[model samples]
Target: MSHALGIAWDMWSVGKVAAVLLVTFILSQLLLSWLHAVRAKRIDRKVAQLCEQSPKHECQSNPPESLPVTLITGFLGSGKTCLVNRILAGDHGQRILVIENELGAISIDHELIDEQAQKNAPSGVIVLKNGCMCCTGESPGSELERVLDKLLDFSQGDSASLVFDRIVIETTGMADPSPIIQVLLRSEMNGARFRLDGVVTVVDAKNLMRHISPQGPAGFLRHRPEAEKQIAMADLLLINKVDLVDSAAMVALTCALGQLNAAAKQLRASHAAVPWKYVFEPELDAVGLAQRRQAALSSDGAAHGPRVSCVTLTAADDVPLDALQAWLQRLVQERHEDLYRIKGSLAIAGEARKFVVHGIHADIQGTLGGEWGGEPRSSVLVLIGHKLPAERLEKEFARLSGSGRSND
Candidate 1:
């Protein structure tokens, strides 16, 4: 140590000590890079072996066109999963593959699956919790590529049905979206399979104030970057749980969130209840959602926990317009307060156009969407709430369509 340092600490000058420390840091970084490379090479070899043993599971010879990816980030208790569920439930004709990224070592979703179910889980991974799967693993350098390859693999020579239209990644409340963004947007390989759609941030209206702090330096917004940049760097801000607060409180929360990210679209939502169109609109489709995204790419990037139930009711036949409308109206009128989110698409009995359905507390609305064309004329409704009676709702939805079908 002395030989490297050149002098004892007591004898060393400030400049000399600083130089030594700088050299030490460089060496440490080099060592870390070497270690990472070694680990990555080993992972590559193992993956190669697996592919060789099972050629049908090999990565695609030609990667699919880039799929848009939406990153869902929020503070704990901020309703990230609620948003996720709403998206998955919506029959928007978009095949979305969701990746649930948890911060800690154990995956709550994985733990719930029994051994057989785990083994039978689809080849494409939907959840990669434990270190956000971005910053940890044997091959940090190519982990995202490897995951995407497996999920998008078309080894069976039939490629038409195996791809996803989009991917949505939900991060743990404590995660900073910055690192995840860097790993995704900055990588050349990631660009081939994915383009960053936008960053949607969910904030709890009633508890947002508790997480804010005085503005710090370096482009911190007036809402000044607290709650782990979950609010500050948002592209789309969902001021969720608005039903919990009064108008005055809502205004205050809205103003604070606006100051944090004035450029972001802010929507007041109760129970993450938002229409698929509004939530997934192509508002950012052009070379646009680009500027802010670029700035975010250049920049840097908790928890509440909630358990809820999701029930999906599907019927093969078309739903009678009157019966469906009456059913939804009654649902919102009588039980909307208990319902967290309700959204789906439907095929009205005689209507050629698809039907868009969405409802929040005390309100439900539908729009005549495009024709189903070759797609099945079926109705799927998803209900997310606490302690829901699945059987009753399922039966109601089935009766609307009046068809023999499986209900799960």
Candidate 2:
């Protein structure tokens, strides 16, 4: 009888231990749940406070009348997209949106822009993908108006009560930005809530001359006049790819650029990467328009005009980087006056990737851009200058290919 009583006592002890453990677990869970609720509440309160603190009619207010717009413009492959990516990646704390114009049918810039936007969370970005925003036509303009309408709706609607703080429009490489500006500056749209911030132009130091010319034997003389127009209209000019130009050429280029647009502020950059502070912190004023107008009026009497030209050559296959470099060096030495810029994508053998090559006068800059996903492509070299000899340029490139030291 005593042994039976001991067993009963043991069972009772086990039951008590199990009950305590269960109670502890339940209490811990309840505590965790309460903590989570508190944290969520705090987050909500913080977001609300931020919303309240943000300037009304700037980002959060409905029916905003004066929204800032930044227009980014550049030539093809000039790294405008890169700068835009950097700006969007920054911590502006305000809601932002982007409008991009793709050069080709592929819309590569759109993908890059979206990728950057996704990386910079919390800010909203929208892409208008029909065609170049600067194109003149019913379809393009209508599309732009529709996009603006949508943005307006967002600003007014409850869903977009926290609307974007800034809007950025990236024009196609070949687009003329004047029309786009006109649309935004329309007096009729004064109530549309969009304001013009400024036009930022990205200039490819290596290809600046080429972009301006694109037609001579060396590919720099063609369409030379239009290139000047682009520079003349810029509010802010970013001279990118500066690393590709030597001191002498860089100085000359800077001098030429200054002559081209004396009123616009010029900034130097490598890989088209610019500081966000300089780009976003500027207080765009009405004086810019006045300055531009004055510059235009005085341009007819200006003596110094753009002297560079451009030439383009397409290669059937990848050429060795070393060979191309040597050729470029020789060209710059022999034809520096006629050779302003050279830029293109090259396919190098055994590298399994594409290499980007850019040159300013005698200076050459190159880097590997990862493996090539598309089909085998030829090299496109755009040479910019005056009086470039097309035959000589071709012969030099061909000779470089023969040396078999092409890969670098």
Candidate 3:
């Protein structure tokens, strides 16, 4: 009877040990899961805070009554997007808003923030697309008036008050920015709601010569002369792509650019990157609208000279990727003399994606943007330059489409 009791006791002990082990395993899993949840929440909060403090967010607040508008301009393939991104990553004590004109329908800048979110960045990003404001017949003055009206409506809304410290307008790569500037200087909407801050023009160090010389691919928009006009109008000139060019070349380019526009401040940077503090400096002097009016009155060359010719080519069908690349390479190499800026969207055969291409002279860059959302549309290529023979350019494209290989 005693031996039987001992065996029963031993069995009971074994059962208790197994139960304890099972409970411990479950508790460990629960603890680990809780830790992960806490970490994720912490990260999300951080990103949200960063987003709120970004320059894009700060623009929502009204700028100084005297100076309120900022124009960010850059040539094709210059690091304008990079600079914008860097500015958005910092905290600049005010609400900011960005109006961007991307090369494609979809803004790649929005995608950058989305990508950061996936990697656990702590910020909320939003993209607003209403088509290129420049292309739209919407008068710049009217647009500003409409935007201010909307903002006021939002500010008075019950949900929450809306405010902005500054506003930034980023023009498209091919857009001539003179009209937009004119709107700011001459628009009746000019008042306490908005002020014209300054114009920042981004230049590519490697492509500056190509942009200015009639021999390069961009030589076609009459680009050399047009680019000079842009340089002349800028308040701050950013010389980007410094890494691709040597120091001597960069210095020479800087001096040349300075000579073109002595009134503007020139800054050299690689990737068009700069400190956020430099861009959103709070130092703004008050200037009345009447002063702006006087300046406009005094300026004689504010209007764009004559309408330049633009040649546009639409693809018959989706072209093969290799074929298109080869064709473009050859065209850029051979006809660099007549190309000002090549801007367009392309559909590559056999690929389930759309490609966006931008070129200045011989320098060309492309990427598979988003997937094909709608039916294949004809590719639109606009070549802007002086004395561009539409027939010859079209003929060359036709020959390339027929030939399997490019002249490369």
Model 1 residue runs over 4 Å out of place are 1-65, 103-161, 187-191, 214-228, 282-408
Structural RMSD, model 1:
19.7
RMSD of each: 19.7, 24.6, 22.7
Candidate 1 clashes between residue pairs 3 or more apart in a chain or in different chains: 76-303, 76-304, 77-304, 173-302, 174-302, 178-301, 221-224
How would you encode candidate 3's per-residue C-alpha lDDT over 284-344 as one tens digit per residue? 1112111222333343322222223344455546677786789788877777655544555
List, residue by residue over 175-282, the lDDT tens digit for candidate 2: 766555555544334445565667788888887765553534766345545456556556578889999888776666665565555445678999767766566554
- Candidate 3: which stretches are off by over 4 Å? 1-67, 103-161, 187-190, 216-224, 281-408
Per-residue lDDT value at 397 in model 3: 59
Q: How does candidate 3 fare on TM-score?
A: 0.42
- Candidate 1 has a TM-score of 0.45
Summed backbone clashes in each candidate are 7, 18, 34
Give the total clashing residue pairs for model 1: 7
Instruction: Give the whole-model CA lDDT for all candidates, comma-separated.
Output: 0.57, 0.56, 0.53
For candidate 1, give the lDDT of residue 76. 83
